[model samples]
Target: MSPEDRPAGSGPQAALPGCYRHPGTETGVSCTRCERPICPQCMVTASVGFQCPECVGRGHTGARRATTRFGGVPVADGALVTRLLILANLLVWVLAAYVFTPQLDRVWSLYSVGLHRNGPEGVAEGPDQWYRLLTATFLHVEWWHIGTNMLALLVLGPALEEALGRLRFLGLYLLAGLGGSTLGFLIDGDWLNSRGASGAIFGLIGATVVLQLRTKGPLGPVLALLVFNAIVTYSRRDAIDWRAHLGGLLLGALVAVGLMYAPRERRGLVQGLTVVAALAVEAGMLAIGMGLYGG
Candidate 1:
């Protein structure tokens, strides 16, 4: 509703239901600049009610926000997001073979380290192994595992990368995979083996879910695809790691929160801080666990 239409003296108490953030405070406050609705508590509360916190950044000059052809889509360097991510995964696969190996099992190494925690027959022996989180993501056992994952990565990844950009999209993929691996480790911590790119891929699905929700777009196709894939993964017995998939999904969501929907001003900073904090926490936990748990 336009400001002129509403009664002035109501103190914005009845204004557009405020932000779901502050329940008590009522204020219409059109943010003076950004024009987004903000509650009284969130408002700067200036002469004409208050300005949006975003507006405060420049100290008040009539600057129009840049509008893009696609609202959420990211445009950066010429490199496409999907290609970059696929390349990164491939590089990791190579690294798992030669570079990261202080010792090489050849057969047991892939799917046992960064992206997925399983290799050979069952999940690897070491839970606190530092390289597993990143390395496990790259290794997959079955022919179909890599095939489907790479396909999905190619298809879903491009749109998301276009929306979120190369770096953020890559971050989401890695973080989700790590989360999945971490959960698998935390739950079984012993017998159950873990492996596959499904966990990290699941993260992409999670991010897409949120992106669809935020943009108010149709998720019917995405939902159907995810459901079908999930069923297949479960029926295949030892072919997939459901637990790691779930963990990676949740972690991907947390990472996606900032990348997909953070406020204009807060987006990059919030995501950066979160990634830094999560990596630090993960490192610390692994260090402590290794010291205490033997392997």
Candidate 2:
């Protein structure tokens, strides 16, 4: 009813029903949901009844839900490990590029080393030199080099980390890097010093392919990209470490396959064993390469 139609005495002092908000005025109407006295300004028309604004807001807040694209388990932002990995690579780059001398680069770059001789770069030849296998993945000599590698990591790492927990994802990266180093040591001329995270980045790519295959998703795009990258790697023989890329791709695919096919009950055991087996294979290959080089 219009204010003019209501009795003038329908004010706070009068004996009349009043809205909670419009305490000085009267309203016979009540919120259908909460049964609170409300005036026309405060009332919201529902399908069959009137509801208060606060009640509608509470309903909306409680009713909202989210789901992942694949309709699998709800997606989570598991990017902590990815960020830490990038930070580590950047920290090493900063130290090598600015804080330390060229000596640091020489120490970190992966080159052929064995029991009998230091690499062509004249890095000290010892069992300790094996560290270069892993360390090289974290070092970069130029801005473009590091930038590209880190961009790939930023794109790929979080997704893989979410698919595989932080530990396994870390294992995949390190092992792929080591696999690349091992292949470089075996095949590349002893004179060439190789460094960068391309191997690990390629591993992520390889894992993406395997992930797609395992999920029975479309493989055309991933496969085409892999082929294109491989072509580029081969074409730039002077600039690219194709051996590292190939090694990482093959090893990463193997790891992904192992992860996909592993039994759910024994998944952890299988992963640990796979990691151990990979390390053993690398060690054996290194031993054989040392023997061949010495001879």
Candidate 3:
């Protein structure tokens, strides 16, 4: 008799199993671990064979996630924080340039004495305006000024952020900027106004050198860049606040050393203490600046 006419028990079967996760799909493949039917969409590659999503997830439950060298969670997009910082600087520039104009300078720029055609006004002259030290870092008027600083930030920020992780990198930037501001305030004449992200950018340059040293990477290019910038800073000392650059560079290097060389057993504690100490130093610098400005 023909095969079609054969009885059910005597005929060959042609049916396939449906996937457990997707019942509507037919699949001949099974999960290696669970031996459950799974479609291509539900398959995760394994050493021996393909596994189902559930099996893969179960295997990962006891495994530790990867982290960066400085105890930061590794990120796929390393430049995220850097981009945000650049955007913030750009936005502040836009506001100071068009929306706020000269008014922003009087209110937010870092200066001990305010001497204007109208009258005397400034950060030191006002009560509780210490925040100007930070706010001024984001203020810029000249196109070339902001352009150069932002370009440097775009270049150095991502790598540092990748090495130190988002939070630590951000703290480094803010603290370095504050260090620059405090030193500039202390050194610059009372009438001189200081504003720009150059200090923070200098800090990034400093941190980059430290990171290269810690990782045992080549130092030629970084050192060349540092030397070039140092020369430029000195050359333009008439216009630039070299003290801010020096302060930022020093603080950034110190912070990077703390972050990179902390004992593995007490890494977080040491890092926290380092940051606190840095802040205390900045506070002390601010007090000295105030003393001189008052005198």
Candidate 4:
């Protein structure tokens, strides 16, 4: 009955609508889009008025996802790539330690030429053996050697992976290893064998330092680490291939500069070219070394 015709105290009043999502809870407010009753918890503020949870979800479905600073897609697990790389390295080490023979060592180790008592054998001996340039980076001489190299990789890989993204980080790592092997082959005696991930680890170090400087992060810790490594390399020069470490460091720093400082308009093109140019430089060094060795 109309209020004017009803008694002063009404016998019954209209019941409030229950929230659509929460059937038991009463709410006066309704979603602007769907016109369904919504509780405060289900309301999502909108441009014109409040929206329900379902409406908000549908609206965002077509929106663009966020990207990282270097144009890589943001990943939920930033360290996934780093962890996989570590696993690969460990697995290779296990194979090298248990299944490999002296002959297999020659197959994987980086050497442009090695002089045996009977004859010469190594990468320069044939084009097919050039794979040694890359494979050598994954080889380790002893328990202590792999232990130290893996430890360094674990320490440095994750942060760089997060900064550079998976593809770029992987590219930097591989190229740095190649640079190290190439430079060591160029400068060291032809008979010397070089194998280890030190070059790649040093590359990460160099890149880390560059990134810290560009971002204006606290630089003292990274600088100190660099200094300590330099001292160790020099003091153990007889046992270490300092040339490889130096080569990797220089290449990594150059790559990082290009990646981090490229013009926003031409970032992708510049970064790709920088990586290609670095690779070309390594190839040129290899050619010059081969010629010098009379290979």
Candidate 5:
């Protein structure tokens, strides 16, 4: 109503209406630049998130907060992502194996939502076109790979989704896969042929690891599990792309932290922004890696 009470910063601008992140807090802080009344607790003045104390301590005199209410806690709707991921991969594999029979001299092509390995073009030449980013994650070279990954997904996905809510869970799956693709592209090195959901699967691993840390799970087992997987991926040297796995793991870890720690409403927003950011970072890294390793 009054000038001072006109709500500070873009307070809660990014979050849902009447659904402030922190129900306990009230005085919404506006972004200094935008005059957006953000919840002092859920404020993101710059790129990073901060609380009222930290925000004020940093000497940010830009804007302030307005009155607000916390939103509902997000909920999981089964492992929607896990099933979608599985279906996509299986469909691609079926098409590739059955519908589009491979030939010795020439290659037959089928489209999948996730990335796919082209003959020799590597990723640059590969069919990673827009659809592949989503599809490539579905298909795996071997049934065993899919089975193992799927099992892991079953073990982790539902729980993760429950913790992150269905929406954020979906975001996690997608962003992790994107990160994995980035890793694959950077490491493929003119090889031009790779596929699988390990990137996202690995992302699940990373997320789980973070969850463990957040809940203070025994550090030794979590660290060991990661180490074992990294060792396997790197040493396998067969068809697996450890780089993608690494990227997924790294991205997953970051995403997990963001989801676990960031405000609930911001989960979707953060995940969306993180995915976009991951893509840009992945593309940049891909370019650099191509230059250095393209050989």
Candidate 6:
């Protein structure tokens, strides 16, 4: 190839000046970096000459993606933890409805009565009944109960999980449920059986609202929704455990505050400890409720 025929950025490999991708197609332009002959289609305009798309992509391969202020990796899809929680609740609800008459609810539901209930013989009871704290969040009697809770979860879980991440969100949910159960069992003395995911759902709401507040995002919508739900809960006092909802909401908000205020270098540790502390508080509450720790 003549020297005059060589492009400004041409290298020895592009001496003949045929497109590397298309041997028959002549390309006067060469990649500004790699200096490979590139056809018009392969050329990516640059400040100097032109670069190949491959070279441009290679240049960016080492670059890290942008993350959220809370250090969460940005996601394009919905929350996996939320979906899994919904699925588990649905499966448990189905089994409770079909496979196990009323037995599942009786065993899993949180009752105001003691762990050792004065009920029919052969019924499962004792310390193991303590599992009701978490299990009750999964068990729902009425379809509307599950439907409302699931819908609220569908709305709230993704946003909260996006802010807190999967593991922390999971911890928030469980601790919220435990907190709700502990408070309900201690306070709601007249109510016999209480079971629903509303407490956990309320926790998700609280987390979302607090996250929005921490990020300085709009909080009107979330606060309004919370107020409306609280009103609805109070209106249905005959049926709903609003006390549990309140407890879970407060606990979730406190956890979110701790998470948001934690040092950036030790955020994960602080988050984990925050959840553990919440659990410890719930445990203490339960022991007190059960008269085990000098209550």
Task: Choose the strongest candidate by lDDT.
Answer: 3
Ranking by lDDT: 3, 4, 6, 2, 1, 5
Residue-pair clash count for candidate 1: 16
**Positional deviation of residue 38's Cα in model 3 after best superposition, in angstroms:** 16
TM-score of each: 0.61, 0.69, 0.77, 0.76, 0.61, 0.71
Against the reference, the lDDT scores of all candidates come to 0.64, 0.76, 0.84, 0.80, 0.63, 0.79
Candidate 4 C-alpha lDDT tens digits along 158-215: 8878877888888888888888888887785366678888888788889888888878
Model 2 spans with C-alpha error above 4 angstroms: 1-76, 113-124
TM-score of 3: 0.77
Which structure is stronger by TM-score: 2 or 5? 2
Descending-TM-score candidate ranking: 3, 4, 6, 2, 5, 1
Task: List candidate 3 stretches off by more than 4 Å.
Answer: 1-63, 114-121
TM-score of 4: 0.76
RMSD of 5: 15.7
Worst 10 residues of 3 by lDDT: 114-123
Any idea what lDDT model 3 has? 0.84
Q: Clash totals for all models, in order? A: 16, 0, 0, 0, 32, 0
Which model is ahead, 3 or 4, in terms of lDDT? Answer: 3
**What are the RMSD figures for all models against the true structure?**
16.3, 9.1, 5.2, 5.8, 15.7, 6.4
Off by over 4 Å in 1: 1-79, 88-128, 280-295
